[model samples]
Target: MQRKSWKKPALIVAVLVAVAMVTSFCRSRETAPAHGNGAPAAVPIRVAAAHRGDLDLTLKVIGRAEAYSTVNVQARVSGQLQELLFKPGGHVKQGDTIIRIDPSLLQAQLDQALGNLAKDEAQLVNAQAVLKRYSLLIGKGYVSQSDYDTYKANEGLYLASVKADKAAVELARTELSYAQIQAPFDGIAGAPLVYPGAQVTANDTSIVVLNQIHPIHITFSIPETGLAGTQASMARGTVPVTATLPGTKLPPMQAELDFINNAVDITTSTIQLKARYDNHDDHLTPGQFVEVVLPTTRLTNVVTVPVVALQNSPLGSFVFVVNADDTVQQRMVSAGPSSNGQIVIEKGLSGDERVVTDGQLLLVDGARVRIVTGNG
Candidate 1:
C-alpha cells in the first residue's frame, strides 16, 4: 500500500512540471520580437527620388542697410545764413537749393571786382594809345628817350593789371556761387544746422545733412572660409542676393552682389560684402538691420534629396537609400547648403537612388519598406 501511494505522488509532480514549462514557453514566444522568428515586416515609408540637377549653395547672414551716399551740407564760404530754402526733413533732388547765405556782401564784392576790371581796361587802352604816340614821336625825335621808355613801361604794367583784374572777377563770381547750397544728390535733407541769420564759416560748420535712400546698399559679412566660393561665383556671373526687412510686410528685395572687400577682417575672420538694390519705393532705410540671402555657387549634375530625408544618428547624418528590391540601406552622406526644401548630397549618392523622406523611425539597416504615395 505504501509503494502505490508514493507512485501516485510522483505522477502528480510530473504533470505540474509539464504545465509550468508549457506556460513559460508561451510567454517567451509572446515577448520575442516579430522579426527575430521570421522575415521582417515591411515598414511603410514615404520616399523621394534623388535627381541630378543644379543645386544653389546658398548662405544667409545678418546685414545692415546703408545709404548709397551721405552728405553734410557745410558752408564753403563764410557768411550769414540768409535763407533756409528747404523745410526740415524735406526730399530734395540733385542741385535743389537747400540753403542760401546772404549774397548782398558777395554781390557787392562782385560789383567792385567788375568796376576795378573796367577801370583797368580803360587805363590799359590809354596806356596803349600813349605808347603808340610815344613810339611815333620817338621815331621822329619829338619826344625824349626817357619819356618814351616810361610810356612803354606803363603799357606793360597796365596789361598785367588787366589780366589780374579779370582773374579777380572770376574769383568774386565763384565766391558768389557759394552763397547758395544745393543738394549733391537725390536725398532727404535734415534740418539746417545753421539757421537763418546765424554766422557760418567755410567748411567749419554743418549747414544740413543729406542721405540718399533710393538705390541703396546693404553691407554684410561672411566667414573667411566662404571667401573663395564667393569670389568664384562673382567671377562666373552676377551673384544673386536678397534682403529681408524685419517688421515690414514688404517682399524681399532682390539685388546683385556689388562689392567685396579686398581684405578680410583679422579680428572677426570675416570678409565684408555689399549688395546694390533699387529701393525706389523707399521701403528700405539707412542703418536698418536686415537678413541677407545669397547664392554663392551652383553645383551641376549633383545628387539632391529633400531636406526631410536627412537623418541624424550617433555616427553622423545619413539618409536611407532604397535599393531595387525595396530594401532600405542607411547611407551616410555629406550634405551641403539646403535651399527650398532640397539638400545637396555631396557624397554617398549617385543621383539615381530613392531616398526615404518619412517613416525613418521604423527602419533599420537592410529593412524592407513599402513606399507610400503620401508622407507617412
Candidate 2:
C-alpha cells in the first residue's frame, strides 16, 4: 500500500512540471522579435534624382499698383462754373473739353481791350502824318524847330501806346481761353469737387482728378543682394515682370521692369523698383496691392533637387543620397537660390545621385532604405 500511494503522488507532480514547461515555452515564442527576417526594417522613402537643368531664380514680393500718371485738375481762371463737359467718374481723352466757366464777362473784357487797341492804332496813324508834315516844315523853315520836335515826340508816344494796347488785347484773349478747361491726357476723371454755378478761383479750386489706367505702373522692392543681378539683366534687355492680385481670379498682368531707384532705402535695406504694364483692359487700378514675380537670373547646367530633401543640422545643410547597395549616405551640401519648388545644389552633389525626398526623418547616416518610388 505505501508503494502505490507514493507512485500516485509522483505522477501528479510530473504532470504539473510538464504543464509549467509548456506554458513558458509558448510565452517565449510570443515575445520573440520579428523584423521580416530578424533584421531591422528598412525605411521606405520617395526620392528624386539630382539632374542638370536650367533654373530661373525668381523673386516674389508684394507690390503696389499705381497709375502711370495722375493729375489734379485745378481751375486756372476765376469765374462761375457754367457747365461740366464730363459726368462724374467718366472717361476723357487728351484735349477733351472737361469744364466750361461763364464766358460773358471774359468776352466783354476782350471786346473792350480790342476797342482800346483800335483807338490807339488810329491815333498812331494820325501822329505819323503830323510828324511827316512837321519834318517837311522844319526843313523848309515853315515851322519852329522846337514845335516840330514836340510833334515828333508826341508821335513816338502814340506809337508806344499802340504797342501797349495790343499787348493788353493778347492778355485778355489768354484770360478768356482759361475759362475753358480741357483734359491734359487720356484718363478717367474723378468726381467734380466744385459744382456748376459756384464761383471758382484760379489755382485755388480743385476741379477733378484724372488717373491714367492704361500702361500702369507697379512699384515694389527687392533685397540689396539682388540689385546687381537685376541691373545686369536690365542692361541686356527688358526685364519681364508678372503681377497678380490676391484672392482674385484674374490672370497675371505682364509688365516690363523700367525704373530702378538710384539709392537704396536705408531703413528697409531694400531697393525700390518700378514696372510698367499695358493695362488696356483696366484690370489694374491705382493704389491696388498685388503680388509681383521677378526673375532675377537664369542658371544653366546646374544641379538641382527638391527643397524637401535638404536637412538641417548643427554643421550645416545636408541631403541623403542613395547608393548602389540600397543604403543612404549623408552628404553635406551648399544650397543656393531656390525657385519653383526646387533648390540649387551649389556643392557636394554630382547631379547624378538619387536624393531622398520623403521619409527623411526616419533615416540616419548609412541607413538601409527601400525606395518606394522613383527607382530606376
Candidate 3:
C-alpha cells in the first residue's frame, strides 16, 4: 500500500510539470518577432501631399533689353567747334542746339554774295530802262532794226547776270545755317567726341550718342517651336511680358509685345521677338540683359505634387501613396513639365490621393506605416 501511494503522487507531479512546459513554449512562440510574412512593419518617412487643381503652363527664356531709338550725332558741316551748346551726358529736346561752329567765314561769304546781288540788281534796273528805250525807238523806227536788237540783247545779258547772283545769295544763306548742330530727337546725350575749338568734318565719327528711354524696347528669342503658340496668344490679345533687372530683387517691370519676326532662324531655330515698356522713370538702360517671363494659358483640373516626391529607377518614375489602412502603395506615374519646384502628375494619380514628397525611398508596397500626423 505505501509503494502504490508514492507512484500516484509522482505521476501527478509529472503531469503538472508537463503542463508548465507546454504553457512556456506557447508564450515564447507568441512573443517572438514574426518573419517571412507578406506584410511587414514599414519605416516611417516625412511626406507632403496636395490635391490636383488648375495650373498654368509658362515658358521661360533669357532676353535682352534695347532702346526704342538710338542715334549717333554727327556734324553736318566741316568747321571748328566754336561752342558746346549742351553739357555732356545731358538731356536735350528735338531742335535744341547741341553744338555751334564758327560762323565768321560763312558770314563773310554771305556778305560777298549780298554785295554781288546788289550790283546785279543795279545792272538789272539799268537794263530794264535801256530795253524800254529800245522798244520806244523801234516803234518810232528812229534807228535801224539791227541797232535796236543790239540794245535788247545787252538788256537780256544783264538780267541773266542778276539771276545768277540771286542763286549765289541763297547758297550763302544755306551754308550759314549749316554752322549750327541741332538735336534730331528728344534723348539723353553721350560724351562729346569733339570739344570746343576742335575741328569737325561732315559725316565724320559720331560726336555723341543719343538714346530715347521713355519707351524702351526689350528683345528676346524663343525656340521656333514656340512660334505657333506665341502667334495664337498674340492673335487672341496682347501678351504680357515681365523683365527683371540683373542682380536685383526688385519686382519685374511690365511690357507688351511689339513685334515678332516673320522668319525663323535656321541656324539656331529661334524666333526673335520684341516687347515695349514705358520707361519714363529711366529705370531700364540700353544693352542690359534681363530675365523674361511669359505666362501662357492656365491648365484645368491637373494634378501637381512637390518635385521631391518623384523617384527614378529602371521601371520609370513612381510615387509612394499612403492608404487609409496606414499602408503604402507604389504606383507608376507620368510626369509633365516642372514649374516652381512642383511637377505636374499627368497620370496614375487622383486628386483625392496623398503622396509622399519629403521621403519616399524607404517605402515598400503593402507595408504597414505609422501615421505621424502634424510632425512635418
Candidate 4:
C-alpha cells in the first residue's frame, strides 16, 4: 500500500511537468517569426533590361558539304594513253587538257579523210565543167541529149561523193579532237585511272574525276514544322544562312538559301533544303560535316530578354520584374519563340522593365531583390 501511494504522487508530478513543457513550447511558437528572420535578407540575382530589338527564328541542323559539280572524265575516242597531263589532285581550268592519247594514229586517219575529200572535190569540179560544155552542145546539136544527160549524172555522182567525203572529214576531225581529254570546268582532278602507255577504250574508260569546289553546296534538312516559315522568309527575298565548321575557330561561312525540295520527306518528316556557299577561301570541303543555322523568320522591334529570365510554375510562364525600388513583382508572360540566347515576349512586362535572369529560384511576388548585375 505504501509503495502504490508513492507511485501515484510521482506520476501526478510527472504529468504536471509534461503539461508545463507543452505550454512553454506553444508560447515559443506563437512568439517566433512566421518566415525566416524578422528582417528578410536581400536575395542576390543577375538581371537584364527588357529592350526593343530584333530576334531571328533559327534552328541549327547538321549539313554536308558537296561539290557544286562532279564529273567523271572519260575518253571519247579509243587509243593508247600517251601522257597524263596533270598530277593526281591537280587543279584544272575549263577546257584545260588533262589527258593525252597517242595522236599519231588519229592524225593519220584525219590525213586520209582529207585526201579522200580533196580527190572527191577535184573529180566533182572536172565533171561539172564537162556537164556545162555538154549542155551547150546538146542545144547546138554538137552533143546528143543522152550524152549530155550522162555527163550531168556523172557530175551529180561526184557531188554526192564530195558531200559524203566532207561528212567523213567532220567525223574524223571530231574523233581526232577527242584524243586530248579536256576538263569540263574549273575543278580538282582525281588520280588518272589510265597512265601513259595504257590502252583506253572509247566511252568505256574513266580518266579522272573532277569536282568543282569553289562554289560549294551544303545539303541539309529541317523539321517539316519549319517549312512554312522558311517558305515565307524565302518569299521575302534571299534568305540568309550560316555554316560553321565543327572544330575550327574560324568565322562562320555566310551563304544563301538556294533550293528547297518540293515535297517533304515522308520517312523523316523533314524538308530538304540546300545552301550555296561561295567557298572562295577554300574553307569548306566536299563531304565535310558542318553546322548550318537557318533563320526562318525575323521578328523586329519586339520586347526581348534573355531566355533564362523566363520561368515557369504551375500557374504559367512568368518572370520576376524588378522595380525601381529593387523589389520583384511576378508577372505572367506569353513567351514566344526563342533564339540566339534571347526570347521574344509577346505579352507582359514593357520594354523599360528589368528582369531577373539568375537567382530566380528564391524569388516571389513582393520579395526584395538585390540587382548584382545590369542596372543597380
Q: How close is candidate 4 to the true structure, as a TM-score?
A: 0.82
* TM-score, every prediction: 0.80, 0.74, 0.66, 0.82
Give candidate 3 regions above 4 Å deviation.
Answer: 1-57, 295-376
- Stretches off by above 4 angstroms in model 2 are 1-54, 297-301, 305-334, 348-376
Cα lDDT for residue 371, model 4? 71
Q: Which of the predicted structures, 1 or 4, would earn the higher TM-score when compared with the native? A: 4
Candidate 4 colliding pairs: none
Candidate 4 RMSD to the real structure: 6.1
Clash count, one per candidate:
0, 0, 0, 0
Best by lDDT: 2
lDDT of 2 by residue, 1-376 (tens): 8768789889999999999999999997778745567656688999999988988799999999988999998888889999999977778999989999999999999999999999989988998999898888788889998998888898899999999998999999999998999998888898889899899998988888999877799999999989998998898898999999999999888899999999999998999999999888888888999999998987999999999999999999999999998899999999998997999999999899999999999999998888995453
**Cα RMSD for predicted model 2:** 7.0
TM-score of 2: 0.74
Worst 10 residues of 3 by lDDT: 33-42
lDDT of 2 at 164: 94
Residue 138 lDDT in model 4? 83
User: Per-residue lDDT for 51-163 in model 1, tens only?
Assistant: 88987778889999998899988988899999988878778988988789889989999999999999999999999999987898898889999999999999999999999
Instruction: State which candidate, 2 or 3, has the greater TM-score.
Output: 2
